[model samples]
Target: MPAPSPLRAALLAARANLAPGLVLQGFAAAIVAGYYLAPPVRTALERLAVFRGEVGLPFAVVSTGIFGAVIPFVILRLSAATRNRYTLAQMSALVAFWAYKGVEISLFYALQARVFGEEQTVFTIVAKTLVDQFVYGPTLAAPLTWLVYAWVELRFDTRALIADLRAPGLYRERIFPLLVTSWSVWLPTVVIIYLLPTALQLPLQNIVCCFFTLLIIFMTRRPTGAV
Candidate 1:
């Protein structure tokens, strides 16, 4: 039998992981709902005092690092093989997430205050969604994610990384398919996120990052034939 095409393979893989995907989506929904309904959570986060002014940039970095990378690493440890240690790849991912969150938060502010010049309005929300989905997300965020994960999987080998860049069909077979899958998840999530107050965006993103990281781990760890 012929092997599945990259897009087909990705579709099958996504279908296989539908259960976890749905669970994560539900969790994301709950977070959005809770953020709106539960005043105390927002109040306490605001009271942190660390998230004020220029401090917020560093706060976002630390918070995202903890939720996106550190917590996931701890969970990975529960498995015997991944216990008691972290690989260089994991460390790389942690650093990448920390840096990305910093930039992400900055861009969020720019989009709200500079580009759209408003918050939670129909025009601003739609503009943010379009820019994110079409421009920044595809060009910057997705490629950075792909490169970081690729670097880790390549064992930080510069030569291999260079070769992979020269590899034929790599973009078609891997990068494009993952981009499609990523947008399927993140685009709508960002729409909901943009609706929230500026102060709440990063914290909520950090919360979502935890579940999203778990979902990635779940999807990636599944057996080849599981799809």
Candidate 2:
């Protein structure tokens, strides 16, 4: 049999790259459940780890265990689907999501300070913003991160970055896959947020979360003229 055309190979590689994003999206979903469902848990986290308060260490342990238990399985699933070895790809995907979350978190904190005054810290404000901005923001962000990397790979392969930006949309022919790819990661995340205790069910807040996640993705890939 004849070898696959270079175009076919390149497209396959692009699709493979999206796997990392998908995996990280699942991780982002789980984190939303962990940090948001329990108020005391979030407070304990702020006190012990990121900032200092009177929260106990065991709360951290329990919370981490409760939410983090799913991580291994998620990693396993994503790894099984991808061409890249599981560990490296999972790490890379997570790292991408983390970086994306960092930006959104910083924005959230800044806004929190503005609206609530600096006197109030994030733990004190038990609103929907906590999970939407910090947790789920990274769902879309992870995919955007991988897409940027994929774009870079195209550049290295001597394809114009501008040209490759159009590639994601070229598969408009495959709308279901694109929709499936995006929502498969997003809808489960929203569901987890809804099902867990202390879920922020405000309509406006949910809308904003949806908007921001898409906005982040757009900004990341828009420069390249891709969706």
Candidate 3:
């Protein structure tokens, strides 16, 4: 039998992931609601500084790492279809996430300060959205995500890595399709994230990353015939 077309495969993956996607959206909504309705939560979040020189960077790193690890683990554990003990691959991915998020948060502040002069306005937000979507998201963030996953899949074998890089249809069949599927989720999500204050952005991103990780795992694990 002929394999499903790429569009069909992407649609199937989206369908398979819809439940978790909705849960993630709802979780984000609840967080937004709580920030407004729950005074104490809002107060605490406000008190948490971001971009405060040395201290804030470490705080963002550790907090994002913890959330990145815990939230995905919980989601994976709760879903019978995904439940499994954490593997080395997952651990490696988590470490990658920790390091990436740390840098990302730092860059976010630096870029904003440099381009937008440390104060957010309509212009700054627009500038940030453009740079994030076009420059950072596609060039750096997306490729890094794929590379990390590919490394994990290849079991850190350097020889396999070189071969995979040279594999025919690697970008066409795998990376492009994954990018298309991912944009469906991340594009709007990042726009919303950029609209918020700097301190809130990484926290929200960490939450969304949990959903993204689970979605990737689910789609990759889909049976050959099922989708």
TM-score, each model? 0.80, 0.34, 0.77
Q: Model 1 has how many clashing residue pairs? A: 0
Candidate 1 has its poorest 10 consecutive residues by lDDT at 218-227
TM-score of 2: 0.34
Model 2: which residue pairs collide?
A: none
Error of model 2, residue 180, in angstroms: 3.5
Overall local distance difference test of candidate 1: 0.67
Q: Which is the better candidate, 2 or 3, if ranked by lDDT?
A: 3
Candidate 3, 33-125: lDDT as tens digits: 667789987776676533333476676677666666666677677878657635646665766676567668666756765777545567776
Q: Residue 173: error of model 3 in Å?
A: 1.9
lDDT for every model? 0.67, 0.40, 0.66
Q: Looking at candidate 1, what is the lDDT of residue 67?
A: 83
Candidate 1 per-residue lDDT, tens place, 1-227, comes to 99888888767766665666666667666766766688985566566534545575777777788887788888878889767445856666666765676668666655665768656888888888888777876787666666666655555667867777788997776566666666666676777777766666666667767766664544334233321
Error of 2 at 13 (Å): 16
> Please, what's the RMSD in Å of model 1?
3.9
Q: Write the per-residue lDDT of candidate 2 for residues 97-166, one digit (tens) a residue.
A: 4344444534554454455444323343444344443454445444454455445334334356555555
Better of 2 and 3 by TM-score: 3
